[model samples]
Target: MINYLHREQILPAPIEKVWAYFCDPKNLNEITPPDMKFEIVSGGDVKMYEGQVVEYRVEFVRGLRSLWLTEIAHVRENEYFVDEQRVGPYRFWYHEHSFESVPAGVKMTDHVTYAAPFGLIGDVVNAVWIRQRLNGIFDFRYQKIVELFGSVK
Candidate 1:
């Protein structure tokens, strides 16, 4: 079954600045939760593009490390982009990162649609673990964003 998560925040920064931050894969580690130990395996200044693929090593529950690969499926410059999982724990994962210029600043949003593996077992796992874990990760990401961009006014 497919599950969804949505989050929106306004950053007190210009759209161009926020766009650069999100597009550069190198900045991922700074926003990710420290506990996850998320690291981009691919080296150098990674730029986001329609066909670019990103690889990462992430530590999940119980200290189990997994390799995840995702492809940037779509891009609209500073407007929005979509990344889909090519290889990961999920049966399917599609995430959209959107940005809009607002009166206050830039409104950034994340829309995630993902399905767990193992059918019934996956449902149980998502209910018991995956869902909460996903939310926790986003919570950490949110806090980290606020720290880097300042409190949303």
Candidate 2:
């Protein structure tokens, strides 16, 4: 069962600043929820560029470690980038990070399409837990972004 999630946030910063911060692999740790214990296992210093691959370990399932690997499949500098999961729990994971210049500030959007491991069970999991967990994760991310760059307008 494929599912989608979208989140938009206005950062009180210029597009260039926001783009640079988000495109840096190091800042990923800063925006991610601390409770997840997210850590970059590889490509920590590598810049977010097309073809760049990053590996991370996150304790999302009850403090158990899970490995996730992603590749920068597409990039339009200062505009948007797409990261596709190469190896992970998800059957499919594609995330697009887009930024636009607005009068108030930069409008950043996160668009994700993913499917869990099991089929029918995955659908149930998404409904019962995965979906809610995703919402919580993104909610945390949104708040952290606001804390870092201040709220929009």
Each prediction's RMSD over C-alphas, in Å, is 1.1, 0.9
The CA lDDT at 117 in model 1 is 92
Q: Model 1, 110: alpha-carbon shift in Å?
A: 0.2
List the lowest-lDDT window of 10 residues for candidate 2.
144-153
TM-score of each: 0.96, 0.97
Instruction: Report residue 73 deviation for candidate 1 (angstroms).
Output: 0.7
| Model 2 clashing residue pairs (backbone) | none
Clashes of each: 0, 0
Q: Quickly count the clashes in candidate 1.
A: 0
TM-score, cand. 2: 0.97
Tens digits of per-residue lDDT, candidate 2, 50-117, equal: 99999999877876889999999999988999999999879999999999998899999999999998
The list of candidate 1 runs beyond 4 A from truth reads none
The model with the greatest TM-score is: 2
